[model samples]
Target: MASAESASLGRKVRTAARWSLVNTVVLRLGNFATGIVLARFALGPAEWGVYGVAQTVLMVLLSANELGVGLAVVRWEGDLRRFAPTVQTLSTLSSGLLYLVLFAAAPALADALGSPSASWVLRVMCVSVVLDGLAQVPNGVITREFAQIRRLVLDSVNFGISTGVTLGLAFAGWGAMSFAVGALAGNAASLLGAVIAAPGAFRFGWNRAEAGALLRFGLPLAGASLLALGVVNVDTLIVGATLGKVALGYYVLAFNMSGWPVRVVSEAARRVSFAGFSRLAESAGPALADGFSRALRVLVTGTVPMCVLLAGLAAPVVGLVYGHEWLPAARALPWLMALGLTRIGCELAYDCLVAIGARHALLAVQGLWLAALIPTLFGGARLDGIAGVSAGHALVAAGLVVPAFLLALRRGGIGVRVVARACAWPFLAGAAMAAVLVGLPRALGHSLLALAAASAGALAVYALGVLPTRHALLGVEPRHGRHARPRALLPGPSRPPVPPPRHSSESDPEPLLDGTGADGVRP
Candidate 1:
């Protein structure tokens, strides 16, 4: 019976992973294509730089928007729905507070980030954070069920709406504001979809016991997640402050391009990995270690070739897709590609470490990354402009953060050997692909058609190189035990088990706000 249940869980995980990959691939491709249009048609580096600033602020806010409690729906067992009202109350209140903070401080924040012009855009784009918070309950419910198809539909709705709105506005000369508005529209659509998916999820209620348990569980993870985001977004802050907006725009473009390859595989894997790893962690030791190894191996194998191609062909890619006017971005693309590749592995390690309830380890690793990043980024900007910044970012990730995360994984019984063995093949294949790409420019010439053919050929090489791991890619996780503990909603190492939400909760139909309805709507 246990064997049958394990097999069933494994099958579900595999299915969810497949759907998530498809969803990510489609959305990223759409986003990529849309960016090319915007970059080439209605916007310039300066506009993108400003948009980058606002986008950065919005992301940081979103990181901690729910204060981490909505995850309770997935983190605990025993009628998870009982925790919904408290999670909803906390999520809504926290997001509202964050939005107010953003609104009141938008000007100062913009100036601090060195893009005073981004103040209005920052205010507009950040509306999504509030919506994201409101949607957290339904979102968590969906996540707990492995409902990736519904998620795909929700995100597709967001993408389509954002695309339509952004394009229309950009063509109408809205510039950076177009992204702000489009993103806001997309989030609104997504929140509606979430409500439809999980009816009655949005309500005002608070269980004192559940609230305390959630705060204990969520705060550290939120802090760590925020730091993780800082590790990524602070680069924009540094570039804008040092090189000014246009240069920041170029850097943002290059960095986004680098993320293309990384996002293709990493985002999909992450959607299910944390939950899946949490389940495996309950089984402990070997099962957890082995599952992570396979997950890392698959992600690294898939990511390597794309990273190599993008980094290798950065010049033509920028010139052909976004036009030569944006060619300056290519200088930073290679180093950023390197950064993106390293980040994928670290991200998988992040999920594994989090699953094993190593919050302090996650915190320390992220803090170290952020600390190392600020100094290096400033120094890099002082020396060689955006490329130097990219190089600095990549250097810190590979040298400092990656090793730190590896050490953290030791807590999960995954030693250096496990990580090295997982990564060795992908690194070798990537090096070969990189070697080939390095010499391709002279032979292929710098034309759109030539670059296309070369990219196709390079991908074919990667396909052959990684063919040996094809079997492992589909069946990445084995039939592991599925025992889960309530406290592992990602606990800090120093924390103890939550004492049963004080033996449970009571549902409340309090209004969402001063004059709002039970569904959080003001009518």
Candidate 2:
């Protein structure tokens, strides 16, 4: 029975991973297509800049609305029935309040941006804020309940519908409203999907104790998010302020393309990690350490090479996706891709912090990122164009990211050596692959076809180089390998001595329990 359950869990993990990867690819592709086409038609530099600013405001508000309510609920996974009401009631009230404040502030923000037109965009997006907040508690519940696959499916469908609607309207010459229409459609679809996907009847009632716990867990997250948002988006703000809207539009194009892969991988990993890690934090030092190591291995392996390849192929990829008019963005692309590595690293560290119940540490790390980001961005934007802005981000990433990881590692009681060990070979392999891709394409005068061929070859070579260590690090052989078993991707039990002793008082403690739920392992 145990074996069967384990096998069932493994299947679920693989299915979820597959669905997540596919959904991310589809969503990114849809956005890329519609955005490119829209850029060709309706919006220009200034309008795009205004649009970017408005979206950032909306995102900040939305993030603030959730704060860390979802995380707190997931952590309080003791009783979903009680937790659900707490989440719903608190989030709804908070969302309503935030909407009022943000909507009221929209006009002043428009004035700040020197674009009164931004007010309407901000107002329209206010609806998303409210809807997003309402969705939060349910969405968190679904995800924590291991019903993520359902959430993924519903959101994917919503994205498809939204993208289709937006593009159709855009081509019909609806201008900025086209994108807004699509967003509205997507949000509505998402709300309905969340409602259906959620497990129980919608209920809301205040519980002061639960709300206090949630506020403790969530407030720092909100602060962290706000700071991180500033760290991430300040470049665009600077670009719009300094270089004008046209340049900001170009920068957004490159930024989105480069950052999309990171978003897909990191967000998927985070969803799984947040739930899985929170559960693991309850017991077993080695199990938690092993889990962290294995998760890092898979994330770095998958993310690092992709980032390097994107950096190498930035020019051609951007050209193909967004058109020649966006060619200037290619200069910004490699740096943007480099920024993804930092972004992913930050995510990994944050997940570790969340896993270890050190949310405050994560908040501090976010503040560190902003501290590094601000001055460099100011300097970079003044010195260079958007490209310089990207360089500044890379600098901030390098300067502040290490401390975040160190802090997470310390808090988790996991040795930094474990993380470093997992990262070494993958980083080397990715770097080597990147160098090969860059050299091969340049040696061949950088034909698009040649770049494509070289990229494939580089990835293959890198994979081969990592093959020996793959089993140890990735916790599984390749999918096609001879050692076939369910849950192959997960790490086996840690050797007893590798993990710290469970307690000084006990002579022998049973091994730490395995953290489950990746690929759908129930236990």
Task: List per-candidate RMSD values in Å.
Answer: 6.9, 7.0
The alpha-carbon deviation from the true structure for residue 372 of candidate 2, after best TM-score superposition, in angstroms, is 2.2
Candidate 2, residues 427-472: lDDT per residue as tens digits?
8888789878978876776777787789888999789867767566
TM-scores for every predicted model: 0.90, 0.87
Q: In angstroms, give how far residue 382 of model 2 lies from its true place.
A: 0.2
lDDT of 1 by residue, 1-523 (tens): 5455556567767778889889888888888888999899899999999988987777778778877666566656567657788888998899999999999999998998888999999998888778877887887777667788987888788888888998999999998999888888877887899899878776778789879888877777777878987988899999999999999999999988988878778877777777676566556477677788888888898889888988888887889899999999999999999999999988888777766668788889999999999999999999999999999999999988887888888866999999888888778777777766666756988677877777777777777777766556645323344432221111111222232334222110101111000111100
Which pairs, if any, clash in model 2? 12-519, 13-519, 13-520, 45-245
Winning candidate number (lDDT):
1
How many backbone clashes can be found in candidate 2? 4
Mark the regions of model 1 whose C-alpha exceeds 4 Å error after superposition.
443-453, 476-523
